[model samples]
Target chain A: QQQVKQSPQSLIVQKGGISIINCAYENTAFDYFPWYQQFPGKGPALLIAIRPDVSEKKEGRFTISFNKSAKQFSLHIMDSQPGDSATYFCAASMEASYDKVIFGPGTSLSVIP
Target chain B: DAGITQSPRHKVTETGTPVTLRCHQTENHRYMYWYRQDPGHGLRLIHYSYGVKDTDKGEVSDGYSVSRSKTEDFLLTLESATSSQTSVYFCAISRVTRGEQYFGPGTRLTVT
Candidate 1:
């Protein structure tokens, strides 16, 4: 069984547009949610994260809107740029065992210049 | 890459052969993990070590084994390789169990 599920295996957006990706989880034990950005031939890097305590978290043009009650979360990229084109993964982990993160399939985003 | 290096970034081995992938860290972190990345599967944890001589299995540990003799090194070995095991492997490090982790570039293994 997949602990976390992500939608829209791929997406395309024009420059200066808003790009959205969604994720849902079945495990309530997960308290930490993180998004990672990966480029070809490189390891994934942490993009943004959020906790259940807050409904929304933003950093620069990237934002994570979390809905604890709905067991869902989504990533938003405002003013999307070509550099933001990459594979994004949504992950969840229990606070006690954070290293054992459960990841969603992934979303491949392409931002047109 | 969080001072982490994985040896034999790309390797091709015949079935029934044994293969070992090494993950070394200079960050001296307390946690090291071995994971496999496959298409449509995202990443699945194979094993993790909390400290030297301390380790535990993750979600997918059936065909793999791990060893952490020193704080800086974590090794994953496949006693008998199989085509089903062909995938990209990644090593990650974290200072604490619930903290953020840094991943290595990855090792692409092909079993023919």
Candidate 2:
């Protein structure tokens, strides 16, 4: 079973437009939600993360909106640029000792300049 | 960004041959994980270790094995490599007090 599901396997957006990627989780026990960005031939790096207690988190051009009741979370990139093009993965981890994170299939986003 | 490294960045082996990939971290993180990435499929966890000599299997641990004898080293071994096992493998390390993990450059393994 896929613990986390992501939609829109691929997406393209104008340079100045907003790029959105959505994810949903089945395990309600998950408290930490994080989004990772990975470029070709590179390992994934943490972009933004949010706790269930907060509804939204914004770090510069990246934003993460969380919904506890809906068990859903989405990533929004403002004023997308070609540099922002990469594969994004959404992950969930419960507040436990191990904190084993389960990741989504991932969404490939491209920003055309 | 952490000091994580995977040795033998690229390797090719024949079917039925044993292959081992090494992951080394300089930060001495307590938590280390091994995952395999393939086309269409996202990263799938193979194994993870919470502490030296403490390890557990993950979703795709059937044909893989891991060992962590020290805090900074983890090894993933394929008893008998198969063509289906060809993929990019990543190693990640995270400290107990840290929320985010740091991944190594990755190892590209191919079995023909």
Candidate 3:
């Protein structure tokens, strides 16, 4: 069973437009939700992360909105750029076992100029 | 980006052969993980180690084995390579204090 589920296997947005990707998890034990970005032929890098304590987190143009009650979270990119196009993965992990992170099916986003 | 390295970035092997991928980390983190990335399945955990000589299986541990004899080195071995095992494998490390995990460049294995 996939612990975390992500929607919109792929996405496309125009330059300077908003891009959004959503994810949901079934396990309530998960407390840490993080988003990772990966470029072609490269390793994934941490983009933004949010704990259940917070409703939202914003880092630069990347924002992660989390709904603790709904067991869902979404990533919003303000003014999406062509360089921002990449595969995004959402992950969930429990505080008790922080090492075990479960990832969702990635969303491939492309920004057309 | 952490101090993690995967050897033999790309490999092409015949089926039924034995293959091993090595993961070395300078981060000295207590936790190390092996994950395989497929086209539609995303990244699935194969195995993980918490300490030297301690390891555990993950969701897709079948047809694969792992060993960690030292804190910095983790090894994933395919007892007998299969065509289905052809995928990109990644290594990751995590610290207890830090709630984030860092990934290393992947190793692409192709079974022909």
- Using all chains and alpha carbons, the TM-scores for the candidates as numbered come to 0.97, 0.96, 0.97
Global lDDT scores for all candidate models: 0.90, 0.88, 0.90
Give the Cα error of residue A38 in candidate 1, in Å.
Answer: 0.5
Which parts of model 2 are misplaced by more than 4 Å?
A97-99, B97-99
Which pairs clash (backbone N, Cα, C closer than 3 Å) in model 3? none
Q: How would you encode candidate 2's per-residue C-alpha lDDT over A1-113 as one tens digit per residue?
A: 33899988999999999999999998887878888899999888988899999999999999999988988999999999999999999988765846368888999999998
lDDT of 3 by residue, B17-99 (tens): 99999999997888899999998788898998889998999889999999999999999999999999999999998876234
Candidates' chain A TM-scores: 0.96, 0.96, 0.96
Worst 10 residues of 1 chain A by lDDT: A92-101
What is the full ranking by DockQ, best candidate first? 1, 3, 2
**Which residues of candidate 1, in runs, are more than 4 Å off?**
B97-99
lDDT, candidate 2, residue A14?
A: 98
**DockQ top scorer:** 1
lDDT of 2 by residue, B11-97 (tens): 999999999999999987888999899877788889989999999998899889989998889999999999999999999987652
Cα lDDT of model 3 by residue, A1-113, tens digit: 33799988999999999999999998888888889999999888888999999999999999999998899999999999999999999999876873458888899999999
Backbone clash tally (model 2) = 0
